[model samples]
Target: MTKKFVTLDDFLGTHFIYTYDNGWEYEWYAKNDHTVDYRIHGGMVAGRWVKDQQADIVMLVPGVYKVTWTEPTGTDVALDFMPNDNKMHGTIFFPKWVEEHPEITVTFQNEHIDLMEESREKYETYPKLVVPEFASITYVGEAGQNNESVINEAPYDGMTDDIRAGRYFDDNYQRIRK
Candidate 1:
């Protein structure tokens, strides 16, 4: 039998964020060739430790994710998340111990920041309650090297295609409010 790989959306959409009392911890590189301990909080992405680069993106997806971390004192930290509130949050805790690392540079990636700004602009223009008809769903799955599943889905019912397509905003236009 061939193993089937499911798209992130399909796998996550059906799940719920699991929780635990024990915190999770992991090592991440500091700017100065030092390692910092990160604590995982509850109500956020699971399995992945806090301060993990991929954890941020995992939270953005529409699904439940959980995370756990163990502190220096041996206390456990946990985080849970639901798909709806995932994108609303960013990096959680950045400990002072890790800040001393000279090799670690804490900063947002240019591409991610740009995409976030664009999403904010669209959200402001169309209230969160109103799902735009032109909103596209990014398919993370790949069928082949050249082809992927990314495509835009139709906007809300009764909205015209033109309206949906017209509402599309360019990434360059969104200014970082902060």
Candidate 2:
């Protein structure tokens, strides 16, 4: 299929619910061209409504699209929506640990999280899969049901750096010691 990237106007007034393999279900409402409101169904922030989160939505195929955004805590997310197949797959990059250690520069070999063999020779590194591609999530319901709640609410400003660092821990060290 030819690649075509469409604008968010195509998705405006749409609502989608997807459940990850890890059992994290999320409800996404496309309010406009730049803003999306989301609610986590099962996670640390469950039931917490994040309103007016800025997002970049692009159509990859006729009915498939890729939506991406960065959270306030420095987390990056990229999700591919496959409505025809009733599936959504994506990856979330948690940069809290890396942010704590500004001295290190982390680079991934690919979206699969494999480390490059050449990089090992250049620097002392313990390669880890920081970005894990999530399994396909089941997409439910039709779009344009107006599932919108009280929109125009305050946008989501994720956790503060220090607090987020405390909650985020890697195998090496905890960034911020409470």
Candidate 3:
């Protein structure tokens, strides 16, 4: 069989709730092919609307999309969304853990300030960090229907398709250096 990938233009919007095996749940919204918004209703960041996460989505198979992005907290995430089976899988690489155990996670830290400098000075680098946590996530439901996790907000208003005007930044715009 031939494998197909989702193109930017052919992309449809994505919104769903998924739960990790540990019972932490998140409501995610793929605002477009390039941006994501989510709310953590459980686990570490409950009740916060994490908006405008830059993401790259690739379709592994029909109804199965892989989304990858870096969070402002220095956390790297790769998630596979399988709506047909009502499941998702994820690997999260956290810099805080790497910061705590340098020997264990000796990999390139990308643009993350503290870890990036450490890796540069030590000359210990790899393309990507070896993720330690594998989260088995199951689809909870769609965005709105009886989901307490949904933040009930419209798509972030500050988003602009004009790349020349401004680069993609989080809702707080902290990533934008003055």
Candidate 4:
């Protein structure tokens, strides 16, 4: 069976692009000092690093779309969308549908939760998948404080320190506690 793909632009909906700054970093350190004479011996210093970042736009629909085929033997297919350029892409799962129906048509609409009273009525018959968003955190700490291995070991330890010191929740910790 031959598969066909389509883009989301063919459907009706709104496309939105969201972007945020991922941030920057820096590091510095000094090694051994001269013991014989009053002069400096082995020493090292490191610089900083930064990153540029952006996110792609996602398409949001308010209702459910319908996928129909003429042949009972035809296989069901999944739909895909592209918000960056406003396109809807999908592949036909069943070749029988093309052979029997000749021309197959699918409806793509916003998947609004309020349209149907019951959740089951809304998505009981279709496939539901959630795509999670990705985020990046740039590490910028004092020299010798930003070791990659240490940084990765207990990434959230810093947060615990803030919480334990009551800085995380207590807004006026500086004045109130002291």
For residues 1-178, write the lDDT of model 1, one tens digit per residue: 1213233333221211111223222112111111122212222222223222222213323354344443321223333433343221122343332223312222222224454334433333221121111111111211221111111221223222222243322333221231
What's the ranking of the predictions by TM-score, best on top? 2, 3, 1, 4
For candidate 4, write residues 91-156 as lDDT tens digits. 334343223332221211012223222332322332322212221212111112112221111112
Best by TM-score: 2
What's the residue-level lDDT of 79 in candidate 4?
32
Give me the candidate number with maximum lDDT.
Answer: 3
lDDT of 4: 0.23
Q: Give the lowest summed-lDDT range of ten residues in model 3.
A: 155-164
lDDT of 3 by residue, 55-79 (tens): 8877776667888997544568888
Every candidate's lDDT? 0.25, 0.50, 0.51, 0.23
Each model's TM-score? 0.21, 0.54, 0.53, 0.18
Instruction: Mark the 10 consecutive residues where model 4 has the least summed lDDT.
Output: 34-43
Question: 1-178 in candidate 2: lDDT tens per residue?
Answer: 1222244445565555666777765666666667677655554334445566688978776777788897543457787877656667878665544334322222111221222233333343333224444544333322342334322222233422222233422333223233
Residue-level lDDT for 166 in candidate 3:
41
